[model samples]
Target: MTEQVYACIDGSVSTRTVCDYAAWASQRLSTSLTLLHVLDKESYPVAADYSGNIGLGSQEQLLKQLAALDEERAKLAIQHGLHMLEAARERVKSDGVANAGCMQRHGDLVDCIVEQQGDMRVLVMGKQGAGETHPGRQVGTHLESVIRTLHRPILVSTGTFKAPERVLFAFDGSQTSRKGIERLVSSPLLTGLQIDILLVGADTVEHKEQVKWAANTLTAAGFNVPNTAIRAGEVDEVIQHYCQQEKMDLLVMGAYGHSRIRQFLVGSTTTSMITKSTIPLLILR
Candidate 1:
């Protein structure tokens, strides 16, 4: 089975951007694009909670009415989901993706992705979804869980879509970082693109050696590679500043290296980077 690029949609403002990014990726990788819309059962409106002293007949009639209303709402949600999928499919096709398709699933987004993981080459999704109340503040509720569950490359779309010409890889000398570098070197994703390997807050000889080793590996693989070490303030701030200053097209990094307990107590660099990044982020696990 040929691997396909999957784009998860939620009918948000970011959904269009996700579709655009997926189209760009599908075109670049020479793969089919699948636009997925999962109607989360939990998000559906439930009957109102009634807790008043009322007659038995009245309560039963009210319950029947609420049940009917809930059924109607569910049907409308399905119709809306199908409509979103169709619009996304047309948008991708209009963007010049030849093999574009869409699927409307009835379950949680993470569950749907897990079930379809075997055929997925890469997953593309927005940082925030439709129901996000805060304007520019929190990451999507499902983003972290999806990242934790899937061991594949997830491209988290930020602002808009632009074909990446220069890419930045955040290296911290961890095993996850090494795996990310290995995947980039082995895949055609970054071939012929200018790549910079950045090591932040570590100006020591050991850190420089690690950065040099990574650069050499990529260089041997025929990529235009450069290595830089910054003894800067904070790792996430430094990386974000460098990307902004240099106008980097894409940011690549490993996700969640610390143990679950440590990550919960100290927070995660991966999560911080994703929340702070302005360009698209390719997260490897």
Candidate 2:
């Protein structure tokens, strides 16, 4: 079975940006694109908060009315989801993706992804969704959960989509980072784009050697790999500053570099960097 790129389309302002990025990826990788819209079951709940001193018949009537309202809301939700999916499919198709398709699922977004994990080569979604109170202010509520649950590479879109001409790879010699480097070399997603290998904080001899080895590996695979090591300031801060100063198109890194305890209590570098980034992030696990 051929792998397809699944682009999640919430009715957020960022939905179009996600579709643009998905189209770019689909064209580059020569893969089919699927625009997925998931109508969250939890979003529509029957209201039954009738604790007044009313008669039993009145209470029953209220319950029936509430159930009817819930049914109407559910129908509207499904219609909205279908409309969103159709719009996303047309947007991606107009953006140069020839084989774009759409799917509408009724459940949690993460559950839907789990059901379609086998054929998924990559997952694309907006960092923030329409349900968010503030736009582009924080990460989407489902973003972290989807990353933790799914093993495929995820592309988190932040702003308008531009074809990436240069990409920054954050390498720290961990198993996940090594896997990211290998993916970069083998995958057609980042092929033909200039790459920069960066190592932040505690630039020891071992760190330098690791950076050198990574650069050589990428160079041997016919990539324009430039290397840099920084031994100052916080890791996320340094990386964000460098990426902004250089105007990089994308930030690539491994997800969850530290232990689970630290990640749960104090947040990981992956989340921090993504929160501070203005460009899109291509995360590998």
Q: List the residue pairs that clash in candidate 1.
A: none
* Top TM-score prediction, candidate number: 2
TM-score of each: 0.88, 0.90
**How does residue 126 of candidate 2 score in lDDT?**
90
Off by over 4 Å in 1: 45-56, 256-271
| Global CA lDDT computed for model 2 | 0.80
The Cα error of candidate 2 at residue 229, in Å, is 3.1
lDDT of each: 0.80, 0.80
Worst 10 residues of 1 by lDDT: 259-268
Displacement of the residue 106 alpha carbon in candidate 1, Å:
1.8
Against the true structure, what is every candidate's RMSD? Answer: 3.5, 3.3
